[model samples]
Target chain A: HVTEAVHEYSIAHSTPLPEVVEQHRARSIDFANRVGMDPGMMVNTLQAQFMLFLAKLIGAKKVLEVGTFTGYSALAWAEAIKGQEGAKLVCCDIPGPHTEFAKATLLEAGFLNKLVTFFEGDGVETLQSLPVDQFDIIFLDANKDGYLPALKTILSRNLLSARGIVVADNALKQGLVADATDKNPHAANSNPGGVMGYEHIDEFNKFVRDNEQLEQVLLPAFDGLNIIRLKQ
Target chain B: HVTEAVHEYSIAHSTPLPEVVEQHRARSIDFANRVGMDPGMMVNTLQAQFMLFLAKLIGAKKVLEVGTFTGYSALAWAEAIKGQEGAKLVCCDIPGPHTEFAKATLLEAGFLNKLVTFFEGDGVETLQSLPVDQFDIIFLDANKDGYLPALKTILSRNLLSARGIVVADNALKQGLVADATDKNPHAANSNPGGVMGYEHIDEFNKFVRDNEQLEQVLLPAFDGLNIIRLKQ
Candidate 1:
């Protein structure tokens, strides 16, 4: 429950994102506009700042990102682990212009080979090939339907470290997951390609809640963020 | 902004709080009603769950709480560091019925003296007496006016560990700290007992934001929560 004024106030009070990451975010937005893609695909600046805070709070060294759109978020994560020895970020995304843009942007930011590696292929396949129990943080920001499968693979295969956390973006889909009815204005655009988008996210939310192995908190901020950790 | 349905949906999907903690929370509400105290002094269930997640995420071992209204939030921290070796939670509050209730409740929960210690004095004095660079997490929920002083003492005295964080509850004061005008309904109640509540909170927010030694993110959930860390 945030008003526009309060949201702006919060952002103004928060630590500003690094200038290089901000530059990448701007370029990503421009690229999305030029290519007629949804700019909302990228996390907002505040969300990025929150993720950075989380990464450093847990001292995350190895991070796995399911979607690396133009490397905006990868840049944020890179900033989080900038000076840590042996820190590495592995990003997986589909092969397309988005990957190309991400590679170039990250390279220009001087973190390409130094801190980040890209696996340009299917998300699930890339996750399957990674070493188990290595990633201290796994960020899920890909397709809605893939959220569940990716989480399942991560847990079943032990892809997350002993103290790792999995953060899933767009878990609520503009509150559609909670109420996808006519009463909600956003519900009108809740579905595309004849598939109910909220259903997939709702299923993911329910699965996370019911799974005895996981404990989660669904933050009702910035579309929705699910912070999950393996029960000790 | 969040609607009632979405807020409910979020709570339902989040990991449930422990049954003992829930019982404590219920008793806290009852105590507040019986004594004509505001139940809002205690944190809601969702906020407590978030704190638990944060504590575990950072593997907090030593916690310092500036407020312990009936020991509700302290119990949450205790659960977070349950089985860890040498874990301790120090709670400071003015001696009164609140302290007695907190002692009884925490003792009933098997945390009094075993895991939590009560200082029973002024918040600032209590903070000043804490060991330097020891506390992994410091919870600030005491008097609104004392927030800045308490934070200053914690910083100047190095009460927070190198990787530790300071969490301030009610940082926004029901959005009044951002907009304390007639346009906001909460503004009228913003001033009580010849003191302006929002101004104190706003001052604390600005001080935290302007301090070069600290980085913070203000989450617009549950009144408002400020997550802060020392600049490395």
Candidate 2:
């Protein structure tokens, strides 16, 4: 568990995200609020920073994101691979106002065509449609229930490279995946989404942990981040 | 903050460390207890897991560790880079029973000369005497006050590869670096080491943040792990 002071300090000391990415995040939150949607769908700033660090750490040139909520994370990924040769980011999200906004925002950020490819459709279908190539990084943050299915597709199709990593967000779902009882404050919240998604997330976690072909580390930081890789 | 249930659940779902490494960790704790040393000086299992993931993420071949307390972390590093060609782990620590214990342990683990090279002396001095070759990863976990100087030397001597990362453990020192007041329980602990190292860690954090040449993310997990790199 992290205290507010400690959290603030950690963020302050972390590398600042690009101004464009920050603007996109703020705009996404505003849009979500205006549309009566939970802005929590977007990755937080610290998570964004960590993802950027990860992308660069692996010298990621090919990235795939199963979810592209308002393109904030896509922009961060674009920033990470901007100058690299032949770097590409593929994002999939169901068609809607969110997808439209993401397209517009990323175009404005100069990443739409140059670096990112947006697919408006079901996540698994989109994964199936992609060319048979290995992605250095694959990020899963879409519908909770779709996580395990998407992962199965990714692995069966060999979309993840030999040395690549898969980063799954909300794997813990506010710790509800681990503890769905009344003790978890999130369980008593007005929104039952956390409790509802508990079964799906827990299933995904267990599947990843038990799958002999994969290895993962579930971090308690944030909503529980799962960094997974194929066993070497 | 994280609850105990969440923490335990997270670890349970994460990948397990190698049996040898786990045995070494347990032995290290027993040795520390017998010698009246704080076993906490060694990294926790979760941190070791994270480091292993990090090394594999970056495909690290050359690693430098400024601290070698009982060789627990060094052993983990050796495991991470084991099969890679020319993989090498260089460790620096003061001459003492700890170093001797570490040597014997690593030798028994079949990594002494095979993958690790141990140095005995002041951390900074040992770092200065090393060759000018770049290391893919450099870990700082020695004397708190020596962090800044060691970093400066590392940079000045071009010891870190272009895309390399420097992971500094205990960068937050039980949150005292952020809030060194009675409000922080660590401030009142019998071990003044946290309080004593407060300024140094704080200074190091600020220096890393302010340096235009370096970018860092200080994670709040596990007493604060700072992942730093040169600006692109």
Candidate 3:
């Protein structure tokens, strides 16, 4: 029944930063491990750092994260939005056993006051029912099959800002997208919701190409991330 | 002497649209048969289509083109903006023997009205002195050496709208950028322009990476095109 977080790697590896930023990232990972939550979905350190760097460069203040497993991915985005004027994150996820651990970690990291709203409900319904027109940036790391539907809902709601950037994680699926039409053995066979929507990365590529409003490029970072933007 | 622009290879056998677009692209290639100036620089028809499609999708109205060799690029952009509610293009290029021919072609194509404006002058100077700051999109295909300077000028002028996208052509340079530090064979002759100011494509890649306010991806289509947007 231990809930304490740990940092296995030394801070010596990272460049100078506010000690608090580095501490939170490590602590966030520890919380996930403590709860038996899989940290496997988190972006690799280099790619995470780069994404944070990009968010900082863009001065992102409002962020939307579609998945919150153990709070590792959420922390990466939250940290990037830090130091900006009035930054906040809206994290969406269905209620799970790990929610308490994630909430505790966010509080411990002093991010509660930063408006990290945690809504416990059906993620798709939550996203569709949300009342908003634009968000500064959005990150997707939830159910793989929900990407397109989530995107459609977000765009329809105008929940993405005019200059907003959208990042979709697990796009490469361990090189599954190299040939989009083929099936991936790694995809979970059990459909928890009675629906399977595993995406072939190539199909997503086609999705981007066919979607005139989005200009997308797939970066083979970590598991692969699709960086997209409003076409303007 | 009839100065007719002809592709010795029969047009029936070629992808004429791309050839037409490339004719708009600027290069010092001496055509074996040049009837009337260079019939605009051959624009990469596909690339032009890409940019134009993006422009329309974003509802871009004001566009500025840094180079108008033969006006093929200008025409492609114009074609995209033509049917829109109110879109216009301001093209900058020094007047030369080819300007007259380009003008005729644009007019014949029915793109000469208010949609296209030709500015005969040093493109860099024009870009620097332009009075406006809210361009929906900007295309850079001017002097190769001027690439960096033109980019700086564009960034300094703040001509790009928040949702604006800037596409720079000739980014790959036959893969010379694969080793950007090495001197390019094309620039070895000590041409004053120095291969459009960058010895290799790597320099441009570095430029894009170093800038904090923009996100750029190099696409391998028609030589190479760099698609960029403000970081946010």
* Candidate 2 positional error at B67, Å: 1.6
Q: What is the model-wide C-alpha lDDT for candidate 2?
A: 0.87
Model 1 DockQ reads 0.60
TM-score (0 to 1) for chain A, all models? 0.94, 0.94, 0.79
lDDT of 2 by residue, B138-202 (tens): 99999888999999999999999998999999988898777767888777762434424778888
Worst lDDT window (10 residues) for model 3 chain A?
A1-10
- The TM-score, computed over Cα atoms with residue i paired to residue i, of candidate 1 is 0.95
Q: Enumerate clash totals for all models, in the order shown.
A: 1, 3, 21
**Candidates sorted by DockQ, descending order?**
1, 2, 3
lDDT of 3 by residue, A62-169 (tens): 888887766666777787787677688888777776666667767877786566888767666778987674777888878776777788888888888876777887
Residue B66 in candidate 2 has what lDDT? 91
**Candidate 3, B-chain TM:** 0.75
Question: Just chain B of model 2: what TM-score?
Answer: 0.95
TM-score of chain A of 3: 0.79
TM-score top scorer:
1
lDDT of 3 by residue, B72-156 (tens): 6677677667766667788888887556656776777666766777778988888888786677788888777777777788888
Per-candidate iRMS values, in order, are 2.7, 2.7, 18.5
